[model samples]
Target: MANDPSVAHDPPPYGAEVFAFSHPAQTERLDSLGDLCDPATTADLARWDLPAGARCLEIGAGTGSLALWLADRCPDGEVTATDTDLRFLSRLRHPALRVLRHDVRTQGFPPGSFDLIVARSVLCHVPARTELPARMVSWLRPGGRLYIEDPSFFPAASSPDPVVRRLGDAVTTTLAASLGSDVAAWARSFPAPLGGLGLAELGMRVHCPTLTATNAAGRAWALSVADLLPAMTRAGALSEAGGTRALAHISRPGFVDIAHAMIAMWGVRPLTRHTEPRYAG
Candidate 1:
């Protein structure tokens, strides 16, 4: 349903004005995110030993890295990479991959559409975060897998370093205000509802990577801060000078702290008929 053209009028929080794919630094930012998180994602998926013809749906497929990986991994299968913005994805050409412009909140697929569904750093931005998991589960075939990952700033929120704390608060605050992101809440409650969705083999893991000024995680964080700086400043969550100072501090050699905890939750849809999931709104 997320590909429905009727909902084209609905604006996404990360719209062109917020974090456009056309921005000069957008590619680097997306790559950095992939660099920082893809290994763990792939590790999880690889563990499943999926069939060569597996059908995968990658929601919020930012730069298409994982989708491309899936295509290569499942050479005989289909991979649908969906995002609200398709500029970056449109550039990728692969026989097994289909790039689609989709808004997860509005568009959707028919029941039993995929063998695997995965999303990273996405549901946190959806206002209906609580309900989307059920909807996603409905799109999976029996014995299918669903994996969801999100970042939580709880550690950074309580950081001892003033600069880290300030910038972290600013970034999270700006995200919450501008994108309706409830990252912290979503992270904390991620695995709660999946059990009721007719899924089995539920599992979860939290990864908290170390952040240094020069590391991929650090660079990704800095780029994100840069992207959100304007909104942060405009909203009075962070001032221009303060943001600059924080950036400078983060770029120093000694800067070290825990980045957001990337929490990954997964479950397998049982191979039996079950009540259809209900969507909220």
Candidate 2:
């Protein structure tokens, strides 16, 4: 989660504009769901034991695209999509859909209220990630499921480009550095936390570190973020010198290969699950 006190981030710049996605021309990828994290998420659901009528709760429900997908999947079930922005609520319309402005960092739901919970690309932005697994369990009934994803970016010891090095250094050494930017390391703690939660039927998958991001659209998105570097530095989410340096490095020729790694984790509540260790015996 955002450990930096210095980085100030408002929500990741969402507006009324509808997002457009691009895909690569050729197919060399192992799993190409293409554009947005939803495809990766939906593929994972294919492996789970969720029947047709399972209820779902989605955190960080950006743009309502994923919620709509889940609603279509579990047509017989209800899908609750929650986010901090009310503007996003304007885009949703589904019979089994419900939207709310729920910020987990401030408050949470009662235990055993949801059958399935999903938070993609979200754990790192929370103020702290300590209570997450237990909270997932708290929101699940017995036999329920939880899914989470995050980046575990660490300072690279070596980078050919000076600019890349600066961005890497900030993310690794200072909490104030990644203030609103995603925390890369928090989600890698996954398998470890799965055991701690006493969750059974646990499994996980690690996706590529370099995404084709070569497609013109993905390239534009990267450039768009790069364009926002100045504002980010001013907002204190990144240092002026460091953010500019990262963009300069990423913009170089053939630099579009620069990609972030994605990790996925899943676990199920034991039907017979009982006592939780508040502390050691």
Candidate 3:
């Protein structure tokens, strides 16, 4: 991913990127994952040249946005999306889409069953991602493709505001402490993990693009950090209300530089690879 130069640090929490906050006016809007799977996010999926009725699988298919997008693109394509949390399963409006509740770390489907598999902004959420490259890809047929987007920040990229910087650190630290897992560790390692799968690595790469909230809706979403601030402070992840104040400032009239970074990587799946032989999922 580092070689591709698109991967970077500083990413939004799952679903928070496009769905930064909810909108009361648009009472019938969809979930964040759906937005991320929009033309902008799923361009990579369109690039896939599989048959019309190809089989596609998406891990951590939040709200089934990506799967639905793929389904719509290849009308004949069958997509199976799995997520232990079914909070947004109904978001999928496509008939070819099948949503299931499954744990990526402990449960999955049969091997070599899919033509393509993708997990965007999901690797960081999984602890033993080392298992993903093979386990997830093992389900792919020969000549299949894999797309993985992760948070990629350079060796020296971070916030300058004392409060904001601390708040960012706190979120990662507290998340790990509370969940008994290190989310930051996984975010820091990417692209390289693919080599462990023994595939003809097309090489891991990412697009370290920064997204700035300049539009009206985007600004409103960026300012809706209050919901997350209180919990962060109470958890001792933040010492002061810096994040709260920063949110207010960034949402102001002159604010123009509050942006987030994202990394996306991809590779190809080969036939007949060593199955790591692990428990289900």
Best by lDDT: 1
- Which lDDT tens digits does candidate 3 get at residues 17-123? 22222434221233432442344457656655886688888887755667777788667878888776566675556778888877776777787788888787677
TM-score per model over all chains = 0.91, 0.72, 0.73
Candidate 1, 1-281: lDDT as tens digits: 78887774333467566666777899999999899999988988888877659999999999999999999988899999999888889999999999999989889999999999999999888878888998998899888999999988888888999888888888788888787887676887757757678777788878888999999899999998888889999879999899998999989998899988898889888887565532211
Instruction: Report the lDDT of model 2 for residue 206.
Output: 67
Positional deviation of residue 159's Cα in model 2 after best superposition, in angstroms:
5.3
Q: Write model 2 residue lDDT over 116-139, tens digit each, in one string.
A: 898876676655566677877788
Give me the runs in candidate 3 sitting further than 4 Å from their true place.
1-40, 153-157, 160-164, 180-188, 209-227, 272-281
Sort every candidate by lDDT, greatest first: 1, 2, 3
> What TM-score quantifies how close candidate 3 is to the native fold?
0.73
lDDT value, residue 57 of candidate 1: 94
Whole-model lDDT, model 1? 0.86
In candidate 1, where is summed lDDT lowest over 10 consecutive residues?
272-281
